[model samples]
Target: MSRTFFTSDHHFGHKNIIDFESRPFSGVEEMNAAMIESWNSVVAKEDKVFHLGDFSFLNRDKTRAIVERLHGYKVLILGNHDRGRSRGWWLDAGFDEVSEHPIVYQGFFFLSHEPMYMNKHMPYVNVHGHIHGQKYEGKSYFNVSVEHWEYKPVPFEQIRDSVAADEEQ
Candidate 1:
């Protein structure tokens, strides 16, 4: 069996993620390296990772190079920033799928980004990125940005109860 992990919004080559967040990272290269390190630290050969969205910046080759270094089978849930050739490049990088709707794995919903409003009709609690908790308050969501400029995977057990409850509705 494979252990599944969820995370989003790495923005690997985006220098602004550090400046806007007031992170200690000095440059985009450092930030990207940190993300790769953080990911590889937790990821193992038998693990599966779901990257919700905004995996990289404007450069497809940069994104592909980073994705190639990370461990696990990556599944790309395409985000707003992921467009055009970037999508295809991501597939080539070894992502299992790229889509708009939620990708259910182990009975939980895996979505690239979150919605502005709540979805009462849906049965599953959305696991997303897009809006970090620092920007949006009281959403009961998790952020993947760890240690200023890192990407960490969050397990389903950490937030499964709430998600499962929502799915039952």
Candidate 2:
């Protein structure tokens, strides 16, 4: 069956991100290749991937090329770094949809490009990206950034199960 996945901050072709994020790769090309490999390994061609943003840093055509090589039917939750492009540009680049705000999924989780606050009254977990390697623990929030998820798209089922477990604890 086709599955759903979540990830963010690929930052494709951004040479400086390696140093800024302390990514272990020796260079941007290697980092980009590894990330693509990791993503394709777990994501089937028909899977739905919610990319929580900062998806790429390359020029328009180059970014589109990278997107074309990626697996899955992708949706983008626009991040701070996702500027300088029209919505049509993102669609043309291969995203099925793009949103500037958070979306609540399956009635139990809030999906967004940036972390959001959830209180006991909200009755939903906040699943987000943007903090990269850091995460807020012992709370109803989860980070799905590439830096924290081994540079691969994490299945939504896994995240849901994790949230369930957290709720129980």
Candidate 3:
């Protein structure tokens, strides 16, 4: 059976991101390789991965090469940095699907590249990326940025359990 995972803000070839996010890698190459390894370690070829945004800063060919190296069927929710290319471009780059805007998954999770406005009164939990190491308060929001997840994707069940736990409080 295939499982779903969420992650974002890889900034694959962006050297500045290492310093910007206080990533521990010595350089961009190391950061990219380590992230790829981390991703493949948990994600299998049959899994589904939703990449929230900022997948990479490399050129099309380079980006495609990196995408091809990862495991799983990938979907991309266009991030602020990803808007430079067309949807078709992302698909061609190895993503199975691309969404230009936020989407609701499994009826309740609002998936986006950036955190959407949500609160306790709202019915939806926002699963998003883009703030990197920072996160918003409340169980209604979950940040899956690579920086927060140890450069790996987070399982959907983990998020579900977190929300469920909060609901019981």
TM-score of each: 0.78, 0.95, 0.98
- Per-residue alpha-carbon lDDT of model 1 for 12-113, expressed as tens digits? 778887877666688988877877887888889779888777777746566667777889988877777775445567787657667655565556353546
lDDT of each: 0.66, 0.87, 0.95
Candidate 1 global Cα RMSD: 3.7
| Per-residue lDDT of candidate 2, residues 75-153 (tens digit) | 9988889856777778888788988788889887889888887766777788888899888875588899899888999
Counted clashes in each candidate structure: 2, 0, 0
lDDT of 3: 0.95
| Better-scoring candidate (TM-score), 2 or 3 | 3
lDDT for 69 in candidate 2 is 88
How do these models rank on lDDT, best leading? 3, 2, 1
Candidate 2's TM-score reads: 0.95
lDDT of 3 at 38: 98
Ranking by TM-score: 3, 2, 1
C-alpha RMSD values across all candidates:
3.7, 1.1, 0.7
Off by over 4 Å in 2: none
For candidate 3, report its TM-score: 0.98
